[model samples]
Target: MNKPNKAPNNKEFPLTRETWRYIKRRQKELDDAFLSKAKWLPNDNARLSALLIERGELINEFPETFKWWKHKADDRARIIDEYIDLLHFLAGMDGMPAALFTMDGGYSRIMFEAETDKWRRLSNDYVLEQLLDYSPNREYPVQSACKVVALATHIMGRLGFTDGDILVAYDAKNAENFKRIAEGY
Candidate 1:
């Protein structure tokens, strides 16, 4: 008997509901594995706090979701708070998964903001000892606040803007355009 080798038609080989369910389960497993292995969080709070404070506000300030908190009250605030709690715990070396999981949007933002400020306040020398913070010079680190501010200014320089350039935009799109240009570099 000669067996014909042919591609299975979609209609002839319909995926069973259970097959979809199994596929979903495998997908979830893979996602979980990737997330678990991700280096999204620094090994310790001090470093984590520095990264968060330096970049946390930018996360919410993205054009797609910028100022979303101004409209949504309860849900956003709660999430931001939760994120704050996580940052606090993490910064203090007391982080737990449950605390992070319980955070709502608002709390998440709050935490992100707090971590940013905390890192902003620490001294350059303290960072070397307390947070193991690094500097290109190794022997001397510039003020963390100054470094962050300069980064913001340089980013603006990329889009034909300068440290003193003033932009006035009336609409979200315009504002976003300016922000994009400023941030593009």
Candidate 2:
């Protein structure tokens, strides 16, 4: 469990291969349960659309990330929740490699570094290009999905969340999702 008073520290819950594996496995379980309840087949296009929408929602949580004049205080808890919400959709996408989360000096760097608004804008634009303009025929869905995850992870880091923090939030959200399904949500 995450201690709310503690500062974000990637070293506390390092991104080991086992930890990445557990996250992937748990996400798959949640996806299976969600799909089973809805009786809906997975569609790549729809998932892509949903991922894009969730990305927008996550972006909405950080007005300070964009609006230079607005000096609102950071809402760490809400930001973490929205990040996990984005992860829920990301897990459903096919071919997202564990290396993106586990590898050294690659995607993991983006997840650990503090992002400036310029870099964030560039990353967001890159994701939009990959998802919207680059792959109309969906020929490279995995690549596009990878970019989306990269952007999401970068944003999470920007919000000062560690990989371990994400796992805790994901666990909590997964249970909430299960409960929602049980209640016919």
> What's each prediction's TM-score?
0.20, 0.67
Q: Encode model 1's per-residue lDDT on 64-180: one tens digit a residue.
A: 233444664234333233322222222222222322332232223332344345544544333223322323231211223223322322222222332112111112222343354
- The local lDDT score (0 to 100) that residue 69 gets in candidate 2 is 72
The alpha-carbon deviation from the true structure for residue 183 of candidate 1, after best TM-score superposition, in angstroms, is 33
| The 10-residue segment with the lowest total lDDT in model 1 | 162-171
Candidate 1, superposed: residue stretches over 4 Å from native: 1-54, 62-142, 166-185
Cα RMSD (Å) per model?
A: 21.5, 6.6
Model 1 lDDT on a 0 to 1 scale: 0.31
Can you write out model 2's per-residue Cα lDDT over 1-185, one digit (the tens) per residue?
22233334543223333444555667777777787867667676677667767666666666565445778965778777876776666556634432223222332443335323324556543533332333323554444554566655655554456767877887888889889878888
lDDT, residue 9, candidate 2 = 56
